[model samples]
Target: MKLLNLQRRMARAVMTPLTHSERMRTVAPDGRSMRAVASQIIKPNDRLTSFERLEIYNRQYWFRVLSAFAEDFPGVRAVLGGRRFDAMAKAYLIDCPSQSFTLRNLGSRLVSWLQKHPSRAGERQNLAVDMARLEWADIEAFDGLREPSLKPEDLAGVNPAKLRLRSQPYISLLALRYPVDDLLLEVRKDSDDLDVASNAFNERHKRKRVGAVAKLNPSAIFLAVHRLDEDVYFRRLDREEFAILSALQAGKPLSAAIESALRGSLIAVADRAAHVEKWFHTWAALGWFCRLEKSPKNEKAASRQ
Candidate 1:
């Protein structure tokens, strides 16, 4: 019973934060206390208490996470400026405390949070939100699972009727009105600034402006956010292409997606067949489709005939 109690005490001691009194009791088996063990960490000339030694770890923990955040959202930092960025970072850290052991998960809620309370506050709010999402996609693409390309031989024996397809882990589709991709590229070059002056696109006046006009167009854009060969790529797709890809992402068969792609317009009728064929080849080459589905029991089930 005494040994058991000692073991429990030892466990609690290790788990809890060490106070000065507790630190004195945390001795080595050879009779040296933790204070002795941590002599190097605690300075001799200073007036700092034992708590101060441990406070260094606390400060460092927040610093590293903040630094990682700054690295992940450099464009955000540039847009917010230094003082506002620091304030935002502190507020963000408080509202959404770190849940993961690594700093990679730090910015997971950032884009969503920014959407709720935008930093720009005016016309640039949507643009800022879009940029945040783009930055998040870049970070997520770097962290997600990377699967080996499926062998061509694997598809050779497959029957199309009984098949179901899955999207790659790193692929995400975003529909936004903001020109986020262009803004991110501009920010990276450290030349362009976010313009929030105009509220609508005037095509007649826009065409007259040189070197990319600062007008907000109200047209909806379908974006494919994916990583290929370790680099993030964002491409804007036309309405039909977007519909087809969205259908495919929903696990609809290739033929069905193609039909959906061509459902509305007479103009798309002639291009449907060729578009479907090319899309299949494109998805295959880009490794965007997966054959294995993760079941409710957490087991992977291959598409079966």
Candidate 2:
């Protein structure tokens, strides 16, 4: 019984989420400092000291997480430059240390944090925040659950008035003041010669255009962030489409959501009638929606059968 209890305690210490205070401790309750602990675990052929061995894990941990952040916030990275970007990255990690087992979950809170504390490391904080959101959505769309598409036939003849439709988990709509999307795309296609000044074009100040203005009226965007055939895409949406999807996301019924969308513009009427059909068709073609909810009539029929 004593041996079992000791084994369980050690397991908990290894697997349980460590507190910041706990992490700061060089040694654990097992009388093993990180250096000694790491050295003890090292294979026989390994020649490094416990400190050096542990340093490898520490270095790789920071590297992998930072790289993921950089990939997720390319536009922000462009504006901030390498030196400032790394500083902001370090600050972010320190403030909200990784809580999940996977590194991908590390940046989930970063955008909201940036919005609250924008002046980090001399970066244009709000712009970086927006870019971070865009990038985060990109990461999520790539990694989130993929549902099977609903066939057009499945939705056909179904009363939109009665059905409650849900947007696929992967699609996200974002409204932004700046053209971070276009700028990021341009930078990705172009060479390392992308100048920070060009990226932050100043039309009023007489600077030549590198890409269209990052800022837009209303300072928001309607975007569809989703994956099709294993490739993630960020497609911009018209106001009507955005409204329709937003309502659906809020769990409004299909008829009500369509009606709300129509109030925004007359296109809402046609779009409402055609939107589900078109979207489902494309969704089916792309394999975005994974499961379909059967109507009451179908459920009854299946029950009787």
Candidate 3:
């Protein structure tokens, strides 16, 4: 085989999913004996056969990928029991394998995959989806881009009718059907002690903790996943607050964003002005707003290394 063809064949063999016992299958999907295929590409060492040598690479590839997926979505695993999470993760990865050079994007398609394959999530499908969304948002916020924030002086005298602002690139707005934020934080706090396959920290324990099951009852939850310094945080938002921020992030002017926030608001028109002022003050303090225009004179953006 030419060098490129040989490299492709090796990658295909390594990426082939392992069996339930985490062993390389004896036969490839094309019905070729794995031993024969291995012999063609690998030379046997003193203590190992060609098949055994190839099996090592195959197992390691899957082990790392599975570990990466688990690390990114521990909250989802908590929602779905460990075993089911493993099975669903394997199936999802087989269908949507990592396409990026880094493992950071491995679970990027997971929420959609769960949506399509609801059976994979069992009884708590919505909860699982929400947990996945929140977990993924955490990932996005941690490594997301940062630009110079609009400071108090920068916004001074700016008119809301014409003010054009953008949300910090790292601020992720999420609308969810469950109170998954609590569950996610709880899961992550104790994740280090939980064994993935043995259900060492089983779902039953979750139900007992302050009625975790009841806490997960369907509710409209809006959140902003944002970073301060080096750590990420989940901030609960009022429905109107979520709407206003999302509208602003969509490139709407301050006046129009406020209008969008008012469309379905339950807060009275008289009460809204105070709430709006408070929201803008809080968001501004958090460095959530960025100037839409850029110039060399603009303060240089700081990025996490």
Candidate 4:
């Protein structure tokens, strides 16, 4: 084989997902022999055979990839416990190997993957999905791109009827079936406390404390995850507020977004009008909207005026 082709084959061999024992099997179910493959490509070191050398890279590759994935989804790990989380992480890696240049993208498909394989998630499937969503939102909120925020003066002459709002690219809207934000916060708190106490204490006591954190409770939740002052925050929103913001994020004009918000049964007709201005002011101060863009129809109407 050509050197470049040989290199490619060796890379695939090391990256092929398999246990150490499976790696030694001859003509295994997958129709590839690690021993035969290694002999063809790798030369033995003084003490290590070609297969032994290849095995080192294989184990290390999986360990590093799995570690990065676990770091990104710490809340999921906490929810699923160590053993199950490890198994699921291994399976997930095999199914959705690292295709992106950046490890941050590793969890991009995790939420959908979990949904498709709910049986692997055991009884807390929905909760696992929620946690994954929340964590991914946080990741995006922290590193996602953003346009310049609209300042208060930028709205000076804007007409509410025709004002189309653009959401900050960093803003993420999520409607979850569980209070995963609260659960994540509690889990993080326990983790922080454990780290602090670990230095002065024993392992058994630390494990007990970690086990004592509050259990997750299911609740309908609407959340806006966004960045403010270089920090990511999770804000709980009313259903009506979420509806309005989501519509605005979807590129609806202010008038239409209000209409969408009012469509929710939770907000009374009388209360809707009163809340519109208040919500707008709160959103503006929070830097949720990037800038107001005049719709073409509105521009034409104003031109005729």
Candidate 5:
């Protein structure tokens, strides 16, 4: 075989999702004995056979990928417990192998994957999905690209009807079916406490610690996940406020976004007009919007002034 073809074959073998013992079988389900294949391609060392040497690479690859995946979704792991989380992670990796160079992208499809394969999560599927979404959003907010923010003063002269505001690139607007932010925060707190306590305990008296999975009642939750400086925060939004932000994120102009917000039953018709100024003030103060999106005509008109 050509050198490049040989390299690709080795990569495929190493990345193929299988246990070491399964790969060592004489006649595997794939019809080719992995041991036979390994012997044909690999040069065995003094201490190990071709299959044993190949298994070393396979184990290391999986261990590193799974470790990074677990680190990225600790909340999901907490919700599912160790055994189930391990199974789910293995299944997810088989289906959605790492396409990106960075380990950070490992759990990118986790939410949707959990939704489709709810059986993998057993009874805690919804909770798992919600936690995955929140955790993934936190990851995005922490490292996602940043856009220049518009100051509160930037909107002073702009007409609300023609003004289109762009959301900050790092900001994420999520409408979840459960109050998962609270659950995740609590789980993380408990995990941190356990870590501290474990360090101080004598080895003979140390016990295995598991996170308490709480029963959370389902409720519609609107959240804004964004970063301020180096810290990420989860801000709960009222229904009306969420509608407005969702609309703006979808490229609606300020007037239309406000109309969308007011159409929701959360805000009374009389109160919407009165609240518009206050909402914009709060959103601007939070640095939610990056800039006003101006049309070519508006740009030309402003240039002539």
Candidate 6:
């Protein structure tokens, strides 16, 4: 076989899903016999046959990917429990195989996947999905790009009608049904304080943890998951605050963002302006807003001075 064809064939055999025990499947996903496929692609060594040699790659690939996936979504795993979460992770990987060079993008489709396949989450589908979103946002905030935030003086004498502002690239605006923030916080704290590995899978321990977490009823709230210095923090947002920040992030000018923020707002007309002003002051202090960058043409013109 040509080199490209040989590589393609090897990849097919390697990416094939594993059996429940983490061993290579006898049958390939395409219905071909893995033994026959392995014999054709690999050579027998002194001790290991072609099938065994190929099995090593198959087992290692799945193990590495599964470990990476588990690390990325420990919160999701806690919600679904280990065995169920393992099965769901396997199924999800089969549906959406790793498409990126790095494993960091492994759970990129996880939230939507959980949304579509609620059965995988058992009784805590919505809660599991929310936890997934929060965990993913945590990853994003950790390394996301940040522009130089504006100083309080930067907004002085500015025209709100035409001044364009941008939210930090790391800010993740979330509208969720459950108070998953607290749950995730507890999960993180426990992971630090206790090994909890045995407790995570122990039915009694899982039940106690799950029951405590599950008692929180569905209440809609807005949140911003953002990074400060090197640590990530979750801050709750008022409905109007969320609306205005969302609009600003979508590239609206400040005036338009404030206007849209007021459309369905219940804040009294007299107090609306004060709220927006106060919100802006607080937001600017947090270094969430950055001035829009100048275009290359404008930069060149300004540099000529």
Candidate 4, 143-181: lDDT as tens digits: 998887788876666666767778998888999988778
Best-matching candidate per TM-score: 6
Which stretches of candidate 1 lie above 4 Å from their native place? Answer: 1-46, 49-58, 119-123, 150-162, 191-215, 265-267, 291-305
The digit string of per-residue lDDT tens for model 5 on 91-141 reads 999889999988889999999999999999988788788889999999999
Cα lDDT of model 3 by residue, 1-305, tens digit = 79999898888889888988999999877787888889999999999999999999999999999999999988888778779999999999889999999999999999999999999997878888988999999999999998888887775555666666788988899999888888777766565446553344445665454246545567788999999996999999999999989888886877889998898789998999999999989998898988547432222221111
Model 5 stretches with alpha carbons more than 4 Å out? 20-29, 199-214, 293-305
Residue 220 error, candidate 2, Å: 3.1
Q: How many clashes (backbone N, Cα, C below 3 Å) per candidate?
A: 0, 15, 0, 0, 0, 0
Candidate 4 segments whose C-alpha is farther than 4 A from its true place: 20-29, 156-161, 198-217, 293-305
How far residue 14's Cα lies from its native spot in candidate 1, in Å, is 18
> What lDDT does candidate 6 reach at residue 81?
82
Give the C-alpha miss distance for residue 197 in model 6, angstroms.
9.9
Better of 1 and 3 by TM-score: 3
What would you estimate as the lDDT of candidate 5? 0.78
- Displacement of residue 206 (Cα, Å) in model 5 is 17
Model 2 lDDT tens row, 1-305: 37787555434334322234323236654565655445455443457565554455555566667788777666676666666788788778767777888878888898788877767834356566667878888888887776666665655555566556666788777877666676666556543434544533432222112213433333666677788777888778767777767887787766788678768585645556676567545645765443447767434433553
Q: Candidate 3, 84: how far from true, in Å?
A: 0.4
TM-score of 2: 0.67
- What TM-score does prediction 3 earn? 0.89
Q: Tell me, what's the RMSD of every candidate?
A: 10.8, 7.3, 5.3, 3.3, 3.9, 3.4
- Tens digit of per-residue lDDT, candidate 6, span 187-222: 666677566456444545545676677677888889
Which order, best to worst by lDDT? 6, 3, 4, 5, 2, 1
Query: lDDT of each model, Cα atoms only?
Result: 0.61, 0.63, 0.84, 0.79, 0.78, 0.85
